[model samples]
Target: MSHDKKCVVIKIGSHHTIAGFNNTELPQCILPSSYIKKGNDYIFGTINMLEECIDKYENESQQTLEIFTTVDENGIPYNWTVIEQQLKYIYETELKCNSKDFPLIITVPHLKNELANKVVERYFNLAFNKLNVPVFQIVIEPLAIALAMGKTSALVIDLGSSGCNVTPIVDGTIVKTSVMRSRFSGDFLDYIISERLNDLLKSDTFQMTDTDGDIILSNNDSTTRSLQTKDSIDIWYESNTWIQDFKINMLQVSDKELPELERYYKEQAEIQIRQQEQLQQYSTNNTEAKLDAAAIASITNNNPLSQKKNFLFKGNKNSKQTVSLELRECYQLSESLFNPALISDKYTKEDGLGEIIGKAIKKAGASVSSVGTNTVGSLGASMTIQPATNQSKNNNPFGSSIGGNASNNSTGGLNGGINSLGSSTTTPEHIYSTLLTNIIVTGATSLINGMEQRIIKELSIRFPQYKITTFANQITMDRKIQGWTSSVSMCNLPSWELAKWYTKTDYEKESNKDETKEN
Candidate 1:
């Protein structure tokens, strides 16, 4: 096959793998990163066949089938065979191109040096030996995100299926020592939402009523179709697709803290109680006359707590059921990101996203300053560290009341500028300021409603000095496929710039050099 000279960008994420030619803005195909294994045979691109395959496996006792994900929580592919098969499927079936004819660009998460070298070697072997690609390159997820946002330096906060990664990129180089990872992410939200849904279903306060106002009973009840059972709950939670849909469509991060939200709901409940007492008193006083239906309807309409919405949950066997829940419950699902204690006992407030970002920034600043270098290599004099300006201290773009009372009093600030690691005179404040100002939040979980606003609010509380500005792709699809699109963008750069890409010839030379070394 003749080379097309077009670059193929493949962004392999934990949940999905996006692939396309570099000429397009968006990816041509986004497929699940999971494969179904039946006995010895592995099946790729099992999106449509997933449910059917699971159903078949359940129905047939003698047959055995297992579903496996190509990548792990860190987005590293552990199953090379499955990954190779998936790549072949993307190249031949989806993109309709030969792997040997075009250059390949893929994204990988930031790993330790030892692990990174091993991973790079594996990918190189797979690209040159297995797939026979002309050229191959690996781009770190955070670096790709920076490129997508058109920034040379950024504090990349990626919230994906596995977890959150706060990586700092200075002058297009990743500050490896400063990267921070947190478990409170999309998959964590899914688990939390599933548990909350399970609890809601089991709670006596929760009532599932149909459109006709008939109470729906659990599956164990002989009178009506049952939706509740230990097995069914487990199965429902295990369904990643359904849980992901619920999280994306229904879940939202609350801008306020848990205490504030709780207080508001408590106050509303108290008001409702008082209204009920008044209604009872009126009824007792007017024993001779019955209250009119219009009066009761008027009171009900006025009460915000009386209004309830139904969430339709589609289950197996084509069964569709509605579960009634307050909007507050849905918002509470994402609160765990800001307050991990809401979900897990092991995590403290320090484990929250804002705190992690703060720590990451501090670490990055400390790492750079420890080297006794005023500027990171190739960053230029324009990017040199400078003293805090008066404008940065007086002007706050995030507003005075956005993140509640600023923590500047407890944590010392440099000339009224918030330092991520409290007051530190030795650490260069400019490095922290630069990273804080250019924060880029991307990933699937970042697509949650009010996520960006909540992050800004949280960061503002901690770091009140710099006007916190975070760039997030407004379009959900664009944000989700950002890694793929960014790789495509990088591939469009000048040929000289792409000299870093490992070509077939380069691989051959390295192999020959290794052989010579052995001899």
Candidate 2:
């Protein structure tokens, strides 16, 4: 618990894992939480190599190599062995430090009690027994994210790979009743992108042609060369690296709603098409014709609907080809986050990102007096700090000890407890005011361009009564690793304040106590 001793901060995300020493500003290792298995050997953090292996063995031999993820779709560790292996690599190869030497702090997603308890117990066992870590603790991602932003209370909107989680942290404690989760997230957007791309490839309107403007293959062809085929699409999806690269490089949230943006672009395209026809029919002087041609070119160049970008698809063997997509198509992928109904009929307009945020705020506002009371019925995990004898009373069975003392003062720690609101009486109005003004958005999906601005625009329309102030880290890295960065900062606090960190001795004592109770 001492600040002098180095602490290891690890954030286990659904898609990626970030790890580093607490003293560092950024994570030392940011790698996929996945591994490739070939025979008895397991290769971790070699996604690019996996892609190459897939290409080499596409049709040459039986595919023996298999890729595995440490966590499930819900961000819970499903494969403990793989998770342990990932940690071992982080400690030995990346950090180049002995696990026994430092205290470990891990960040986990906020989930239901049964699931949260399972995740926590698995990690605690992994840290103490497997890694031989002397001290260990788990901090829910929302709390760490709040501390990282230097706010004890904020509406934290985490747009992660697995899903979008809108958690309300009141006085540094998670408002369990107010937490809202949705399936609209990074991976969902990826699926939407793949589906859209498939449709575009099959359509005659959008054709993939070579430099000479000739089609590469017949539309009916189902071979590897034709990306239009289902088999080829499956191959492309399997090479997740290329799709991930495309998402990161090209995806962006539109400034306006998808329907409005589409309408505007459609109008612009029509006007340009009419102008082109007029220029072709009318005969004018050479200078006038040249001027009109220049005007049309300027219009086409400025119009996003008319503008297209070519990306090389390298997922298939001997199938490297340029796929041209309208800029509007790229924007549509992220726009689905704002309007989930745009992609599928299963989701209604209420399932959008803005609506989720509004719902979380309303739920938090409704339960103002019960904010720090620690029980949220069966809908969510309880926030209550359990007695030493009862570990199952709360989602955080390790209790407030893991949270530290999240003071609103200069000294940063995990906030929550009987006195979370401090000496001053916090009314419903005061809590609502704090949450509305300090909205914090963090996660990989939030890194998309215009995401922060779009959220703000949406929130302003929903909550006209209050002044909305949303905070998103301008630094791209900071936003991606906000949870880990905050965990490191929490480790820097004084030893007494971080008493929440469970030690090996404490675990032993608790184990002995449990044994006695069973007898």
Candidate 3:
């Protein structure tokens, strides 16, 4: 099942994706600023941006990149729709041009680091990319973090300011046999804290004020231009907190539309009912005179003042309008958070990450797991970019960026820092899945984690004795891995410059020394 095509993984981060930062007049969204609240519902806004981004790629190289976006929805955060928006945008934009190569995998968000290598490099390349030009798909931020922290069997944690979740990995293959769950990510922690504080600060009038002496009411950051009446807050907090509105403008166009919708729907229903009655009435028997009279022949009077006949509109357009028809079948996953009769945080708190499995070594479960994995993740992580030691992840790009020359032979990100003894392809080419937690934060009602185990089991059955790690960061066993670990390093050995930090001769020697001491 191998084809010869390359796949690309382009991920936009929270800081870049979420907007309204300079602390404009808009009230800041306690969470990621990607949506605007329309009185009750959260309107998705990021779809426009993603559509624009995909257009850039397609226009440049005719490459209809397949995007597998993951979403994490814990504690009623409203960003899953943003991921949905991106998917919809991709589909509509590509479909308009009649594209078939544009496929997308939308699943729940994932956070473990070890799974990075296996999911993206190994499974993605071997399965998805091989079916097409499948250049390597790049791992985005959190996965990149797991790849950077050098360790074989360790827990990876990322508490980014926007969101937070932890991933556990063992060796290269994720310990599917263990217990797994998704808690309130760091993003949740931030907003909950903020909201709880606001709830406590009401006065006799029950109006809460900002840091300044102004009354506050909501969470959305939409207002753009500056006006009076809003008290002038501090200058420093302006960028982070002072946005009063995030919307482009405050026009209640929907109200005007509601009346028209109702009128149209009622009008259509009445027309249909009248037409049915007419058919039933005519079904019996009608003389030619009766039928012709019903058809409304022209009426005339001889010289009784100037008479003119006005014909009713006989257009083929439907006279009736549907006001609020069911757009999509919405299942009650849970009630909206902002609604009255707030649901308890206990059962509804489920972030919808993988939570169900057969409770076997083959099932790394989540709270919302089912059959096929809606949320898939790569496992092999840990990069050893030794250059730019002072700067943490400021690694060299493979070549220059897209605008720059593509003649760069040196690698970037987890590239370089490879002095391996394995005969593998690409830099740091032996990555493995240390966990099976593909934590897609997107809102898919059906998801599972055993798919990772299933992939592993099948691969094991096929290869028999060749330990199956991913293709990103290469893995090595001092001796051959008879389908098991001999001695594995997440990143290959360190380069000569980084070796100065190592008092020992090499990584292999260091690994062997640790093993010998354990014995």
Better of 1 and 3 by TM-score: 1
Off by over 4 Å in 3: 1-9, 12-144, 160-164, 203-519
Residues forming the 10-long window of minimal summed lDDT in candidate 1: 397-406
Candidate 3 minimal-lDDT segment of 10 residues: 478-487
TM-score of each: 0.76, 0.80, 0.27
Task: Choose 1 or 2, whichever is better by lDDT.
Answer: 2
**Local accuracy by lDDT, each model:** 0.66, 0.69, 0.26
Q: Put down candidate 2 lDDT per residue, 320-365, tens digits, no spaces.
A: 4567777787787788898888778988879889899988887777
Q: Residue by residue across 469-505, what tens digits does model 3's lDDT show? A: 4221122110111001100111112332321122112
Write candidate 1's Cα lDDT for 248-312 as tens digits: 66777777786786677667755765576667668788534544566655644554433455667
Q: CA lDDT of 381 in candidate 2?
A: 19
| Backbone clashes, each candidate | 2, 5, 70
TM-score of 1: 0.76
Which of the numbered candidates is closest to the native, going by highest lDDT? Answer: 2
| Regions of candidate 1 where Cα sits further than 4 Å from its true position | 1-4, 51-62, 203-217, 221-240, 264-309, 373-427, 511-519
TM-score of 2: 0.80
